[model samples]
Target: MAYVITKLCLNCKDIACTQVCPVDCIYEYKGDDPSIPKEMLLIDPDECIDCNACVPECPWEAIFEESEVPDIFKDDIELNARIVGKERFVPKRNPDDPIPTPEQIAANKEKWGYKP
Candidate 1:
């Protein structure tokens, strides 16, 4: 099964996942809905090799196997598949991407309703 990215990734565009993605399946998200919040990345469920390449790279702890996706982020499974083919998503990586600090990651998780 493919890996799913959850809301825990919101605003935490750490690209560490992108760097190690051997298949280059992860894409930058440009959706701006109120529910989407800040920028994040989406793994193209179609292109993903189920390699688990990105799971450890993400500092946000957002990526999970399709079956392991948290109940709160279950919708994200469909989201990743739906957005990968839409105009709002692209596989571009920025040269000056930000590396979030520990505190920022903790805050991001908290912002999305996770106590961690």
Candidate 2:
């Protein structure tokens, strides 16, 4: 099975995991406006190679194997697939790109009302 991105990534949006994915299956939902901050990143199940390379790269520990996804966040599997199906997925930023700064993360957390 493929990996899944859970709600823990909502505001954190850390791209380290994306950088390590060999298949470039990781994507961020840009919504309708590219200028707006993305709500979360997603792993395209169809494209993922089950490499598990992205598991440890997440600073927020949001990635999990599809079958191992925690019950609380189990719905993320369907969310990921639905978003991908809607063509809302976009390739991750360049691996050499920098991740969000602490300030940015904090702002996003506030904007999204993310408790974690």
lDDT string, candidate 1, 8-67, tens digits: 876666667887888877877565554442377778888899999889888778899999
RMSD value for candidate 2: 5.0
lDDT (tens digit, per residue) of candidate 2 on 1-116? 88998877875674678778887788876657543236788888888899888997876667889998877777888877755554455555555656666676566545544555
Candidate 1 segments whose C-alpha is farther than 4 A from its true place: 29-38, 88-98
After superposing candidate 2 on the true structure, give the runs of residues whose Cα lies further than 4 Å from its correct spot. Answer: 31-37, 88-116
Candidate with top TM-score is 1
- lDDT score at residue 107, model 2, on the 0-100 scale: 69
lDDT of each: 0.75, 0.73
TM-score of 2: 0.70
